[model samples]
Every structure is written in structure tokens, then in C-alpha cells.
Target: MTYIIGRGYGRALLTPDGIFFKGPFRRRSIPWAEITEIEKRHHTARSSEWWDLRLVRANGRDLAVPGAFTSNRYDHKFEAKLALLREYWQRAAR
Candidate 1:
């Protein structure tokens, strides 16, 4: 099974093989074995506040899954989707 989440200019696609990220101008594919960590991080800018999923690779590179962007209202489904993504990652890691 595959799961996809996100809106606007970025999205994250979770699959049994890996996680694929589609950003505004680039795309990244990280295989399950190459992923070292998956974390949720809080971000605050001058006018934007949101939370995102951060994927850390073995080579020390970080990728942000920007599905939780909350510019005006909160995205209530963010946590649920985050949990689902983690589940996929854990299953692949095993």
C-alpha cells in the first residue's frame, strides 16, 4: 500500500520501498534503508507557524515534508497523517 499527504507546493509520498518528496522545484527519493530518523519539528517564521516532518538520511541530509503548513488555520489531520507515515517507516525498517 501507498500513502500520500500534503498540499500546496509540497507533498510526501510513502510507499513500502521508500518515501518520495515533491517540492516546488525538485523531487527527492529516499529508500527505507537510507533513512536514519523521522521527526516532527515546529517552525515559526515572521508570519507563518507550522509543524513538519523531518527525514534524516544516513549521509546527514535532512528533508522536510511540508504537509502540515498552517498559515491561517490549523490542519487537524496532520497528526493522524504523521502517525501513518511513521507506521510505514517502521514497517520498512524492520
Candidate 2:
């Protein structure tokens, strides 16, 4: 199972070993073993930009992830946030 928390800068998808990134261009991931803690963050987006969702994973080690590629060509970030929640099922214990 996975756990998710959104922040001002990005959202973190917490899995067994780590979490994924989404926002301002999906970025690399931070390993869980290295994560010290998880924080809830929020942000108000500019009216023109997509809704800003973020999560902070406090880890010293970061991992390279698959490129940020969306296949549908929908070009919607809000929908992408839902995709993460679906793909990385939140951990029951988290």
C-alpha cells in the first residue's frame, strides 16, 4: 500500500520504498528508507495555472524516476493528481 500527502511545491506518493513526484514538471523520487518524515502542504495556484498540489518527503536520498510522460495528450495536471492516487494505492497503515 501507499500513502500520499500534498504540499505547496509538489505531491509525494509514498510506497514501500519511496514516493513519486508531480508538479512544476514531475521530478525524481525520494526513497522511504531515507525519508525521515512526511509533511502536509498546501498552495493556492494562480488562476491561469493548474491547481497546485504538493507533498513533502523528507529524505536525504533521492532516486531517478521514469520520465514524466503522459499518454492521453489531455494536458491536464489536476487529472494527473488523481492518476497518482489511483496508481499508488495509499497505504492502509499510513
Top candidate (TM-score): 1
Per-residue error for 22 in candidate 2, Å, reads 1.8
Model 1: per-residue Cα lDDT over 23-89, one tens digit each: 6666878898888888877878797776767788899988767564444345667777777878988
TM-score of each: 0.73, 0.30
Clashes per candidate, residues 3 or more apart or on different chains = 0, 10
Candidate 2 regions with alpha-carbon error over 4 angstroms: 1-10, 39-94
Pairs of residues clashing in candidate 2: 2-90, 2-91, 6-54, 7-41, 7-54, 7-55, 10-54, 10-55, 11-54, 11-55
Clashing pairs in 1: none
Give the whole-model CA lDDT for all candidates, comma-separated.
0.74, 0.41
Give the TM-score comparing model 2 with the true structure, all chains together. Answer: 0.30
What C-alpha lDDT does candidate 2 achieve relative to the native structure? 0.41
The TM-score measured for candidate 1 stands at 0.73
Residue ranges of candidate 1 with Cα displaced over 4 Å: 1-7, 46-48, 71-75
By summed lDDT, which 10 consecutive residues of candidate 2 come out lowest? 61-70
